[model samples]
Target: MDKNLRIGIAVLALVGFGALIYSSNSKQARQIAASATQAPATQASAVGRAIVEVKVPEFEGKAVLGQLAYVAKCASCHGENAVGQVGVAPPLVHKIYEPSHHGDMAFVMAAKNGVRSHHWTFGNMPPVDGITDAEVGTIIAYVRTLQRANGIY
Candidate 1:
């Protein structure tokens, strides 16, 4: 083939590849946006009711300790077993909190610095008071365990 023809083919191939990448990325972004807009069940009357049914598997080792810490520190708004609360808080066991999405450090930062509401309409999460970083780690372990069991991972 002529040199110019070869260059033209190469340019076309690159453009095609870039289009493919953009298409894939846009689809993923749309999916994430769709999920984020679909809020969980919320009730005006029930403030702390469980919004989703959570299947809690028996805990062991660090997860056991984590569960206790989560209950003491996070359950009031996040709900029992991290199922979430109606008109109060979002569920930690939800796909939104999966490690690939929210990660462990998100939990730590949210606890330390508070989080602005984006996913749920319940409102902003004020920085949790009187909870140490160590406790937050344990709480993440517990929530992650629950998330995995519930197929969020």
Candidate 2:
């Protein structure tokens, strides 16, 4: 082939490859957007919640372990230190959470059985699996201490 023809073919191949990459990337982006829109109520609710600043004092014993478990398990939607997600999850540090109304047992029940949305618009609180009742108790202890510090008692 003539030199000019060879160069033209090379340019076309490069252009074709570039187009292929761009097309693939665009399709993947659209797919991600679609999946997000179709996400399960639980997932969408969790993602909708915003990340917030979390501050907690020193803790000991079970409460300390509870904090670890909470961070690993509930911090996603509940917000760190149980600060809460406005539309996604209710704040655990609020006055409404006083033991008088939402007893410690409530936490256990919710963790085990999942609770329907009532207080906040965040769909439903799905039952968290793989965590024992005792661990739930520790998490409640951590939450209660935080609540008391924030004047929830």
Give the per-residue lDDT digits (tens) of candidate 2, residues 1-153: 999999999999999999999999767755543443233666655554533344566787899999999998898878888877645566687655689989998899999999986544457889998979988999998998887776677
**What is the per-residue lDDT of model 1 for residues 65-134, given as tens digits with 9 covering 90 to 100?**
8999988988988888987776668778887789998999999999999999876666789999999988
Question: Candidate 1 overall Cα lDDT vs. reference?
Answer: 0.82
Per-candidate local distance difference test = 0.82, 0.76
Best by lDDT: 1
- The numbered model that scores best in TM-score is 1
Query: How close is every model to the real structure, measured as TM-score?
Result: 0.72, 0.63
Stretches of candidate 1 exceeding 4 Å from the true structure: 1-44
Q: How far is candidate 1 from the true structure (C-alpha RMSD, Å)?
A: 4.5
lDDT of 2 at 153: 76
